[model samples]
Target: MVETGTGTLPTYTETLPRIPESARTARRLVDLALTVWDMNEVRDAAEMVVSELLANAVHHARCESVRLTVTRLSDSRVQVSVVDRSRAHPRRRAAGSMEESGRGLGIVNALAHGRWGVDSLAWGKRVWADLEVTSGE
Candidate 1:
């Protein structure tokens, strides 16, 4: 993979309050970034991934704010990550068919084609997902 600062892979970041209402805003941010980066190919999946990650941060991370980062890695790959002020990392577990929750990471894994993981930050942790950029119909 090429380095991010070669001017080919544009990036965007936004720090938002950790509130339930911020989830919608986060999705909109992803959509807008994808549009700006001309990576609309993966907008839907990227939006879903952002929403899930942001929602998890808001609901689980007992922090004041979170940062959302979106990077266009290439013509066909983009990475979305969320950083929060909590060390608690997310885990994937088998979700029962009838379960109403506990499936955010699962959805991310499926959408990202198993290209996702979490990293610990100085103050918290960041969860990221890399998804294929395709102009889906």
Candidate 2:
């Protein structure tokens, strides 16, 4: 069963491994989307953010685990965060020539309903985004 805080559901308090090819992949994220709250649009956005963040973590930092957090915030929005032991923070670069990447954060920022960022504390950094939940519940 998922836990809740007042109106928030699930809270996204999961710590999965950060292996390159861990089974806790897209399907697992989608499963969480369905089980966490209830909104098709929100699910898709959250799943995309999670997948991108997870992929970035593995591809760039080579992390072996991430802390996933999903919390329903005020003003009808869902905040998604994936914390990893990144060597450093994410860098925002323009679309370079023949570049096949460097647009994940921009996508997250565009889709989310509110402010989002990738920051680190004493331990490491966390990549998070927020979106308006349209579950209609």
Indicate which candidate wins on lDDT.
Answer: 1
Predict model 2's lDDT versus the native: 0.68
lDDT of 1 at 95: 83
The top-ranked prediction according to TM-score is 1
Span of ten consecutive residues with least summed lDDT in model 2: 1-10
After superposing candidate 2 on the true structure, give the runs of residues whose Cα lies further than 4 Å from its correct spot. Answer: 1-10, 20-27, 30-36, 134-137
Prediction 2 TM-score vs. true: 0.76
Question: For candidate 2, lDDT tens digit of each residue in 1-137?
Answer: 13457654546466777764542464365557555465455776777777777777777765567777677664467777778776588766677778898887777777774478877767788888877855553
Q: Candidate 1's C-alpha lDDT?
A: 0.85
| After superposition, candidate 1 runs with Cα above 4 Å error | 1-8, 135-137
